[model samples]
Target: MIVNSDLTMGEGVIERHEVETFLTLAEELHFGRTAATLHVSTARVSQTIRKLERRVGVPLFNRTSRHVSLTTVGRQLHHELRPAWDDLRAAVQRAIETGRGLSGALHVAFVSPAAAQLLAGVTQVFHEHAPDCEVRIREAQADQILPRIRSGEIDLGLTTLPLDDPDLTHGPVLVREARMLAVPAGHPFARRASVLTADLTRVPLVRLPGHTDIPPRQAGAPPATTAPTAGTFQEALTLVGTGQGALPAGAHARRYYARPDIAYLPISDAPALEWALVWPADRHTARVRAFVEAADTLIHGHGTTRQPPQ
Candidate 1:
């Protein structure tokens, strides 16, 4: 069992500096190092630790002429206090952000033309909710979206859904576009009303760098060993337009990227492509949550479809 310190004593309450010194000394175990890290004198570090030991009624560290290490009680206290200290700091930071009324910059990005158009509507609504918060928007290739979000380069991303990565948090499915097959306009499949999953066996599929939801080579499909790779959705469509390969695309592409040489047909057996707001798993900040709420409002309240920009 652990003895509780009189942390709540009136007027005699333990100060923040005491807790900081205790945790730091517990981690560093060396008096000089702890003092250097806290920018205080070794004597001050010794005084703080002694005061804490007196308060706890036990020594927290075992000291020798050359070695310093945590006592058993010290280990227990560190185990309990470290996470609590982190949570306390985080709560204070959040309070600061909230106190400032969310009046800061929110960085957002979109992965596709359809996503960009939809983001335009979300941004308008977000502004209504957070007038002082500046929403900075950018367009990124599909592969760049997750990296930017993870590295804190961007706060949120509007991109394809069903990301299997554990580090990413996918928000609600804000937009759903029917799956379509983009074939060369003069190809036989273009004259057909729709294409089946089995039909993919006969056509080479273009590879979009980071789009994982597209169908893979079907059971008996020819090996895509020599398939072309596209950096952007438009590039993928262009590959299809040149008869290099067929592309599985969202229905919105037919409207936003209409081309004379490319024909889009419904995929009779494909699932709709889902789009949502994605952010780093550890970065669900107030601004991120607020932006997600705005997006939810746009999709549910307004029933915004993935249509070409008006």
Candidate 2:
């Protein structure tokens, strides 16, 4: 929570871009690099800094022919203004979240039934944290979750872990469920106590549609004999139940989507499935961060609110 007056100085409230330019250049100490980082021209950075100096009634930088450094006053201004600027930004973000109401639409998607349960609990806790914020939930096919978040169609997603990419920001592990193999109830492997990864992919594996790079081939596991294409999680499960193929899944499936025809056998050598909250890198905001924190608390902290990562 912050007050705008704390950021305002005298009658002439300084422009934001100027502050940004000053602070960025202060840290970068290179006009070209600062401009590049800010997506502005070097000339623009110079103009903005000069303007800021005039407004502050002092030289902010000691510029030589080959180099640049923050003047003593500039250093002081950077130290003092940085925190105020952060407060101002936080206040504005809070105001935006508040103006939109904790009731504003916060679209979220989930790909698995276990993730759905965790998200339901997260949604409840998030609502309690910010009653006016509304959480809109949707079912997402495995292949569609990341795309929807990247395309700005959804604010957040509950999906599998290890989605390491530059464009995505994934939160901490919400749940770690043991891995299981979904096979036709009558399959020979279904009768076994457990299946090893070395033998898990001997049969065809139903894959999430649109995901072209299937994993066993990459992970050094037994190569799947077939890669059946399916558009939805249920479709993939149904394919496995009917003997079309097998699918690796979280153990939660045995409870939420148990079927007489579908046998979920433990994968003795498989790693646990880690589900986390994920959102696009650029769209991170107060709401997204707050909701993620709430989720981390409820799911990882066992109902007690936990401090989010710095």
In terms of TM-score, the best-performing candidate is 1
Give the RMSD in angstroms, all C-alphas superposed, for model 2: 14.0
lDDT per residue for candidate 2 within 1-310, as digits (tens), equals 3233423555566776777888899999999999998899999999998877877788999999899998999999999999978877887886776544455779999876666777788888898878877788998877788889999899999887787679998888776667778889999998988887776558888877644223233354545676677887778888988889988777777887789998888886666666678998877777888899888778667653332211
Give the whole-model CA lDDT for all candidates, comma-separated. 0.81, 0.78
lDDT of 1 at 61: 90
Best by lDDT: 1
**Tens digit of per-residue lDDT, candidate 1, span 226-272:** 35988888888889899998888778778888999999898878777
What lDDT does candidate 1 reach at residue 146? 89
* Least well predicted 10-residue stretch by lDDT in candidate 1: 1-10
lDDT of 2 at 1: 34
